[model samples]
Target: MDFFKFLYRSRSAFDYADDNPFGISTLLNAIIKRLQQRRKLTLLLAACLCLAAPCYAHAHIFSPLLEAILPRSSSEKPQASTAATDTVTSDTKITLPTDLSNPSTTTAPAVELELTKQPRPPLSEPSLYALLDAEFAANRGNTRRALVLYKQQSFKEDATAVFERALGFSLNNEDVHESLDFAKSWLDQNPDHVPAWFYVAHLALKAHDYTLAGETLNRILRYDPRADLSEILIGIYPENDDDQRELLAALQPIDSQQNASLSVLKAGLLNQFNDPQNALIHINRALLTQPDYVPFITLKADILRKIESTETVLSYVNQARLRNPDSKNLYLYEIRYLLDLKQSQQAWELLLKAQNRFNDDNEITLLAALVSLDVEQYRTADQLLNILVKSPAYLDQAYYYLGISAERQQRFEQAKYYLNAVVREDLVLAAREKVVSFELLNDNIEGAINTLQLLRQQYPVFAPDSYVMQADILWQHNEAEKALQLLTRVSRKYPDNELILFARAQLLDDSKDYLIKRTLLNHLQALDPSNLSYQLSYAQLLLANNRSSEQGLELAKNLIQIRYDDPRYDNELQLQALNLLASNALATENYAQVINYLQTPYDVLPTLRSGELLLRAYQGLGADEKVEALLADLQQRFSFGQRNVNDRVQLY
Candidate 1:
């Protein structure tokens, strides 16, 4: 029974100029309005209203609430006494009609309801006394106290009227646990009551007790074979394997009915449980039931993804897309799967079809642009990105990609213009850095430095990286002294900056300033002791210093001792360390030890440094034939600028 509607009808039509005097609260009205369809507990409700009918003789409680909230066997009429409230059976279940004749519930809460004790003569019924104030508190917006009073008057023996009212209050409060507990109590009293079972099953679902919900749903279906349980079933979410298994087992009876939506839900649950084999069985069953169902179609693809190859999955998705041409999600999935398979031509063709069908959706247009670029369709990428640039949301990214497309086509001038137009802070730095590459490619060192300086000016956090790049440009242009000066100036400003210091030390070493380079490498070690590159630099610098041969040899030996299994050891580092050891031995004229160290490194990588060291070792051992053979190999393999191997060995 919709008590709120019945309460609405009870308000007399005195035409009081837009006002309702019954004082019904909105919270209770909204919660109770959903229950108007169940027409089976009007008898107990009519008695509850009959008590109020005499109390507020002005309310004119004339609505058919008596027979609606408590449904009878159609042969028996509602009696004045509460004698029939003791039996909990199908005949006693409340079934409210959905017809609402009055709009008082919406207008009632504005006027305060004061059903004080001086209203009427005393009655033996205690619930009648409390009901007056309960309605008063409800209209006053004190829903908690109103619900407390409603629950107080509602007992198991003869409490169907007030108990359902209390259940409505509990729903308004959003107390799922409390509602479930109260629903279980009401169900315990009324074992065969469909309305009670309906509420109990839903509350169990809300509380995430899927086993109890599935069991109660079975009972509800037994009584009312056409009950719509879509709301309750949609809320099933199992958190783990055990919960999934329990819920799946409980739903066995429901699954045996072979309903389409239920089969799909079960299939989804099985998929989430990672049992794709069983999930496929149920999804296939659903497809058989409803062949064109989109969810069933997509779920089959998802299940196949776990067991099938990408080619097979993409074939299935393409077939589904062909069948459902208007499905936007299918188009998106097809594009994604085709891209994963590296079939960009197919993806591009599908995207063009989607663009035509979808009227050039901006997101799809942007995706098409990226795909065109991937497939080297420069003209198509340019066209799509140009359109996307008109929209504010996609403007920043559009300009950025337009720059990349132009740059890839060797349109350096146009690339710089488009990239420079990107004003987004995240993309601006990368865009300007690309411009620097274009400048350097044109052999314009000044332009590259100027661009880097602009970046440093705009984004100070990246100033150190920009400064390092500037120094590299000078060093690459054969201006070593100028590069050293720039690094020295920046290093002074950022004395503790490791990147600048490392760049400065490399420049110093290349300029043959070993004393300063060695000092800088030592300071770097103190800053970050685990820096293996710095350690390698220190060993190489010491080996080059004639006076520190013993120290250099010991450090090189320590470095080479790190085995292949060690995290600190990589092939390049080991080879570098070996070259250092062999160089130290050759310096000391220990030809035998030099040969032993250089043999493995020469075999692994015949780099100029290792080859040159081996040639020196062979010469120091008086193995003239080995020295000549090694020199011939080095000449064949590498360029020595204007100094060929024969010309260079004349110095030794």
Candidate 2:
């Protein structure tokens, strides 16, 4: 029988007359019969009745009714009505009502189930099996279904694990916001998880939440003291100096003693801001703990160098070498220190030691070659450069230095070959200039001209310099008119070109055409009125033409006095002025003044012309012994070709 028929029979047996006045059984029977015909309509009425009643009313009303209609087997045990609650399934538990006769126990007359008050049951093994399905789906690359399953499982059991899986899947699908939310929930469950913290910190950094990132990093460090966060922090370059300072300040509370790498990074940042003094303090602190750490030592040395404590730099680098004897970089640092101190020989020795230790290292080889070049050890430089040229890392620089080494050794052809091999754009013009110079030095005038021409065509940026070089070569070949014409043409093309104008003036001065020379010099001076070199040239021309000898002498004397009074004045200017003064004095037969002017030092003489004039002044003063000594000194110090003593000694 259906529930309604059983209920009606039971009610009839109990109190059939008054309690059943409403005929609940008859109505229930009608509903049941109708449910067979219209099941949807029956479900709708049952849902409405269930919603309309209180939860305790349903229990009080149903318990006795169910007990009366459903006969229990002898083996079946009855549940106590006083029990508060019991589990129904993995997803649900139901609470039983209190004593129905108690007024306080009474609920609303309508059946209203309060499922929210019941404690949920723990997920069963079937839910775990569903989690496995989620894993499989995720593995199968069905991320959408897997996320839904994982989320549903989170509400069931092991929410941390569920959230972690969801996060992993979300990240795999590149759903960053979802992944972040899942990660946050997972971390909330397990805050001490280091890997999770790393993701949080990384994402925080990406989001530019530096404070949060720093806190996360600190938490990670507390858990694992040896975590290397130096690279991560260093990679975060701020937008401005203030932001960088703020970042460094944020990191300062972390113990530098525990992380020396962080200290070194801060020192580097400080050095970049030109705060070498403070930078040194941090670097030294790091070095104290990590004396054998090569990078810290190198940073300390660099900071000291920036502050210009050369002796201290040398001492620090030497100490670093003792601690890290096998460190090639320390050796390089020492070499660089010595070179900066102008102790070239010491630098060369250190470079050789570095080469022996790191025989295959190209950087050491390049340094050795460059230092050898500096100390005039051409053969050693040449050998090192030959090895360096084979390595692409140092090929162009090696070729450039090899050319210089060969040129120093007077191997012009080899120098040209090496120079030509230099293809680095920065080195090309310099290499071409050297090639042209070497060609001229080798007495191949035509070759020099050809090289300069090619250089002009290939590197038009250097065309003006090439033009000047070509003019000089033509002038050396006694082709004065050709040289002058070349200078004129280039000067017109590059009117403001000082080099071309200077070359033109020189040719005119050589031809003794003072008027045109003065005009060109005036134009140059007009272009740069403050140019002392141009002023000196103009004065020299004035003295040469004897047009304004006294005025020229006075101007030259004033220039020399200016150079003497102000040590910052150009040495070349001082030399030129002295040469002019001495020449004018010699011409005027002012032997005493000439002696006073030129007797400062032989080193002070600007050129061979000044030296010759000094000698003539000594001759005019009738000091034969002084003359012979000066003559011998000049002949030994200078290469005066096959000219007689008088011819060599003649100024102009």
Which whole-number lDDT from 0 to 100 does residue 624 have in model 2?
76
TM-score of each: 0.51, 0.52
Question: Candidate 2 lDDT (Cα, whole model)?
Answer: 0.66
Candidates' lDDT values, in order?
Answer: 0.70, 0.66
| Residue range 1-652, candidate 1, lDDT tens digits | 4554654554432233114334333323432443334433453454355435434644633232232234332446635334332333323333421211110222111112122212332322234435545665665466666766665555423456566666765566535656677668656645755566667776776577877888887776565444455545544566677777877777766743444556677788778778898888888887875676676788898899888888788888888888888888889987987887788999999888887788558888889999999999999999999999889989999999999999999999999999989888789878988999999999998899999998889888888888888888899889978988998998989999999998888887623798789889889999999877788777787777662567666777778888989888878887888887777777778888888998777876788888888877787777878877877777788853235655566544
Clashing pairs counted in every model = 19, 7
Give one digit per residue, the lDDT tens place, for model 2 in 1-652. 3543543444444233224524533544444454455445344335223322323323432332222213221235434222112222212211111110011321212212122333434642114334544543544455566666665554343243344444444555543334445555546545544445656665455445667667876775665444555434534566777777766666667655555556786788789789999888778777776678787878877888888667777887787798778898788778877776789999899889889999998878888888888889988988898898788878999999988888888788888999998878789889988888877777899888898888878878889888998998888889989999999988889988998898888888524687788888899989988787778888888888783478777778778777455754886777778777877777778888777877774655435666677788988888878877777777777864236665554542
Instruction: Give the poorly placed runs of model 1, Cα more than 4 Å off.
Output: 1-179, 182-206, 220-230, 233-257, 307-316, 423-652
lDDT of 1: 0.70
* Candidate 2 segments exceeding 4 Å error: 1-316, 325-329, 340-346, 353-362, 374-383, 390-393, 510-515, 546-570, 603-607, 639-652
